[model samples]
Target: MTAKRSKVAPRVATGGGALVPLPVGLSEKEAAQEAYRRLDRRVHARLGAAVGGVSVIGLAQAWGDWASHLALSPGKQMELVWKASRKWQRLAGALGRDPDSE
Candidate 1:
């Protein structure tokens, strides 16, 4: 007796009643390169916007602090001045500048 192998039919029927394989045109390398290009542009744009926002906020805070000092008493004003000077010294040190020299 000869053994017969049965053929499997398509799970889903197409318009022509034929099974068509899914199409994937791009190779792995090409797909990865395309994805990286898109991601890089998106990340760079977001980072630029964030940096700009931080800079604007810093400027606004500095201006507001300066304006509020105008209404302070002489003793209180001096205290604010000392505090600001210390903050400046710390900022300079963080930037690799010598706080005591200049």
Candidate 2:
């Protein structure tokens, strides 16, 4: 006798180009693993969206600044100033800085 496969369709689509169905008739461990996998994918998706939004907003602001500067200086070129910040003072030791100095 041949084993029969269920004809139910998947309820969710995953980023890895596949459909993920609800875990049914699975043991406690198996169900928990499946839930964790779905949660991980969701977290990654949200993070990607946040990073993309920040990137787009930064580009838009930079472009606006460039346009305003160009308009104000018709013939002269605009000078750019690069600013650096040390936000990881606490993590300096982890980044190869001397503990005593930190």
Candidate 3:
């Protein structure tokens, strides 16, 4: 008879040197948002490079086009930020308490 070997999972290291388990039960929207946030970082870096390589007039035109395309006035953007912050605040509050906590 031959002996069988067991398979092991890869370990992820945390800042405290502990092997923290991966998060579970994220909804589709949450997963998409996480992906978008990562993409946003990369896109922002590329935008910075593009802006630096272009002339001032080109940069200004690009900025104007982006603002118009998004159709977000400064006031509306601020309002959106406020609403997102409040939504996250509520989510954090809900997560902080145990499911059985009263």
Show where candidate 1 strays beyond 4 Å.
1-24, 53-102
Ranking by lDDT: 3, 2, 1
lDDT of each: 0.62, 0.62, 0.65
lDDT of 1 by residue, 6-75 (tens): 2332132334566443224544454445556655766666866877746655777988997787676688
- What would the per-residue lDDT of candidate 3 be over residues 1-102, giving only the tens digit for each residue? 533322333233543567633234444455445556655766666777867756657778998998896685787788889999999999999999999868
TM-score preference between candidates 1 and 3, better one: 3
Error of 1 at 84 (Å): 7.7
lDDT by residue (1-102, candidate 2, tens digit) is 534333443345566667677655555555556767897978767876977746655777999998898879845542322111234543563778666885
State in Å the error of residue 13, model 1.
31
RMSD of each: 18.9, 11.6, 20.2
For candidate 2, what is the lDDT? 0.62
TM-score of 1: 0.29
TM values, all candidates = 0.29, 0.32, 0.32
